[model samples]
Target chain A: MSGHGLVLRNICKKFGSTNVIRNLSLNVIPGEFLTLLGPSGCGKSTLLRIIAGLELQDEGSIAIGGREVDGLRPKLRDVAMVFQSYALYPHMSVAKNLAIPLLMRRLCAWQRIPVFGALLPGTASRKSEIIEEVARVAKSIGISHLLDRKPRQLSGGQRQRVAVGRAMVRHPAVFLMDEPLSNLDAKLRVQMRAEIKELHQRLGVTFIYVTHDQVEAMTLSDRVAVMLDGELVQVAPPQEIYANPHDRRVAEFVGSPKINMIDVNVCGGRLAEIGGQVLPSELTIGQGTLTVGIRPEAFHLASSGEPNSISAAVRLVEHMGSDLFLHLDLTGVPDPIIARLPAASGHIAPGNRLHLRIRTEQLLLFSENGQRLKQQASVTPLREYAR
Target chain B: MKHCRLSFRTLGRHGFLAITTAFVIVPFIWMVSLSLKPPEEIFQASFSLLPQSWHATQNYIRAMTASPLPRFMLNGVFICAVIVVFQILICAPIAYALAKLRFPGRHVFFNLVLVSLLIPSQVLALPLFILAYQLGLLNTYAALVFPFVVSPLGIFLFRQFFNTISDDIVHAARLDGMSEFTIVWRIMLPMAVPALIAFSIFSVVGHWNDLFWPLIAVRSQELMPPPLGLMAFKNEDTGIDYGPLMAGSTIVVAPLVLVFLLAQRWFIEGLTSGGIK
Candidate 1:
């Protein structure tokens, strides 16, 4: 299917006095999967709701399939959502649950009446058509055998699939998902994550997914929109967002084992921690204290005789099987800085002091205000990864 | 640990419940027993729970044959069914609006229902009676059915049960392209089967045994419900034949007892639990 695109312009929403979505505007390309990633209560779900017309925006307009749908109802907007709780009709069997949307769309008022409805002209034909369609979608979702069972009889994973199948039957212009897999167990979550990715590829539908889990956003989307405090902080491809975050909040929120923030000052063209020299600056800078963000993987064990290696004490060592994370304390830095090294790289235990080098090329410098400062050097040359 | 030795607290609870149950049930048992006893035994000085001899066939035949009792029962069934159906049709949507829909004055409307609940239907009897006379509905089945069609207690009960259903299910239904009424009939009502049963039992029993309202609004003998007909039967002939009266009482009470027994599980669950999950 060739998916339709969505354009949200200046969407603003407020719950009572507090702003929930602030002047948010985004353009989603046709057939592209975009994820809205944020912390809980950051209004990503509210934004998705606005796009689906489940909730109206206080100001601004939304377009789906190139048509303005600001005042339209959710069903008319040609969009379907898989809610976090599944929201399956408790009274309906799986088949009836799948057949409901078709029933509402295809049957007239009198045509849906109990006994007389069966006697209505074209009702039987339409009903049989609906059953066929429901069967097809159920087969596609691998829930064909479960059609006779009630929602309560199904496992969590099965319910999740049925929820997806409900939306899939519609073939709407856009698919909206609000943390649909968050309710599953960890193993099921990982397994379902791949299924969702494959589903996205197979349908090739424009998808707007809202999630608080960064890993889901990173793995499932063609582009990820990082939201903070009701505003979009940054929107870029996952790799680009991870490597080059435009805002400090985005940098801090995106990575696991978090990117460490170190306070440093410029001394004789070299960057130094509060009480000791750290790394030599490759780019020219004004003389003032700044924050430098360094990813854990950017640090490496220094040779005994290497220049500019900072000697630090290993406070804790976390063995992650393939890679080992060493929590180290520099002479001046109060908090421990973590370094992820190859697990095969010799035995390093807690309390063992090791000299470590910072790959100057991969070093991220920030002004006092928490904005990333680009360096003059062009580097895939993360001067650290070479070691 | 699994032995049947009862604690003091458990013994007290069972003791209190048993006494109340006997107090409530003894009259019905006595009625059934009296219906089986000959008229002379019913007036005997000696008290007995069961009759000395069976006059059940004669008493039941007399009850059925006397005073158009079958006609009275049919009227009761018709009035109760109409009242319950219309009450549900009107109350479910009102309850749905009160419970789920977001609109201006929802709180005010729900508060009004609660306020109406605080006032007994007897308080409205005067106005309803006058209105029935003005509409020429007095002595007609409409007089009995109309006054109860929009029951506030039903609205309140249904709204409470609807409140327990997740808002997400409603949202999902709306997105599935169902109209509000469709959601009420197909989604909300089916999910609320227990509550409906509980409400229907309350409605059917209340109207089935009702005598006071029917006495005021409907005066014709043929239009009278079972309870009212039984009263007319008492004043008709034989002055006060104890046997047939008890037989009619048993007949009138039988259907409700059977209904309650059949739906006892759901009736209890509906009263205690709010929603399916």
Candidate 2:
């Protein structure tokens, strides 16, 4: 089946005086998986609900498959949503849960009665068709053995798969998932994350996934839209969002253990942090104070008296088997800067002094208002100091 | 705490419960005993839970064969069942809207339901009578059932239960293409088995045991529920006819007791599960 593209234009929703979604617009190409990634209360789930037609946008229009669906009901929108709770009907068996959307769609009202439904013309065949499809989806999701059981009898992950299978039953043009894996334990979350990516690949359908977890968004989507306080801050590929984020918020929100932000004074053609020389750079950032964004992995070990290095005492070292996360306290800097180094950088512990140098190419420079700026750097390599 | 011998506190608590249990159960024992006793022993001054001379067979046969007692009981069953079913049908939808849907004046409407609950049925009896008479529903089953078709307490109770259910389930059902009524029936109703049982018990017990409304609503013998029919039976006899009356009372209460015993588990759970308070 050909996937349908979705276009949301000028969507604005207000919960009383507070704007939940403010003039948001985004376009999803056919057969692409796009994730709405944001912190909680960032209106990501609200956006998904608005797209599913479960909630109306106060002032916007939504078009799915090139048709405006502003007034259509959720089922008529040709989109299915898997809710955060999975929302599998707890009373229905897995098989009946899978058959509901098809039953509700294919059969007329007269043909939905319990025993009399079968006697009506075309109902018997349609019911068998529904049953067949339900079985197929159940088997595909590895929940065939669970068809006879109620949702409460199944584990959280199994219920989650059944929810996905229910959505897949109709083969809707677009699939909307609102934090479907947040309830599962960590181990199952990782396993199901791969399965969801595989499902998107297999169906080749437009998928809009909303989540607060950056790891899920980072690993799953073709494009990640970072939202904050009811506005889309940046929309780009996952690697681009991580490597060259549009602004400081996107950089801080995406990466784990957070990117280190140091406010540096660009005084007299040198980059200075806390009145110490970080490096001499010639990129014009309009001279004054500039914030330097550094991912924890950007720092490398250097000699104590390196010209571009800042000397710091190791406050803590966390071993992650392959790498070490060192919480270092630089002189005159209040917040400790974390550096992820190879564990083979031997014998590092708390109270040890080391000089850390910022790599020029990996340097992220943001303006005073937290906007990313140009970086065509000319770096002067450091001179090592004598004891 | 786990392995406990008889402590003074436990003993005292059990003693208090036993005394209270006897106080609650003594009247039921008296009714059954009077049903079984001869008329002489029933009227005698001496008190005993068991009958000395057993006249149970005679009293029961007379009560059954005396005056359309079986038909009165059949009427009770039919009316109570209809009231419960219609109460659920009417109350569930209203409760679903009040509990889940977002709309203007929703809280006002819910507060109105609570207000309606405060106005007792006795206050509405005269107006209900006039309405039923105007509609030509007098002395019919419709008059008996229609007045109770929409119960404010049922709406209030069902709404309280529905609030415990997650909104995501409803949204998912909507996306699954089920209509609001279908969701109420298939999704909300099944999950609300406890509340259904609890409300059904309250409605059935209330309507079945009610003599005042039935006396006011229906004059015909055929339409009379058990309590009203039994009251008629007592009044028609020249004397008290205490034995047959007590036997009939036992029969009238028997079905309700059996039903409560059967659904006793769900009944208690329902009341306490998503409690009103």
lDDT of each: 0.88, 0.90
Clashes of 2: 0
| Candidate 2, B44-151: lDDT as tens digits | 887787889899999999999988999999999999999999999999999999999999999999999989989988999999999999999999999999999999
Best by lDDT: 2
Q: Compared with the true structure, what per-residue lDDT tens digits does model 1 show for residues B93-209? A: 999999998899999999999898898778989999999989999989999999999899889889999999988888899899988888899999999898999999999999999
- Candidate 2, A268-387: lDDT as tens digits: 655555425445566575468888888999889888776666678999999999999999887766799889999999999799999877676887878889898766543454332211
> How well does each candidate superpose onto the true structure, as a TM-score?
0.94, 0.96
Best by DockQ: 2
Instruction: State in Å the error of residue A265, model 1.
Output: 4.0
List per-model TM-scores for chain B: 0.95, 0.94
- List, residue by residue over A1-387, the lDDT tens digit for candidate 1: 879999989988999899998998999999999999999999998898788777889999999889999989988998999999999998889999999888988999899999999998999999999999999999998999999999999999999999999999978889999999999999999999999999999999999999999999999999999999999889999998998888888888988878888887765554445223345556466577777888888888887756656788989999999999888898877788888899987999888878877765666777678888776322232255235
The collision pairs in model 2 are: none
Error of 2 at A325 (Å): 0.5
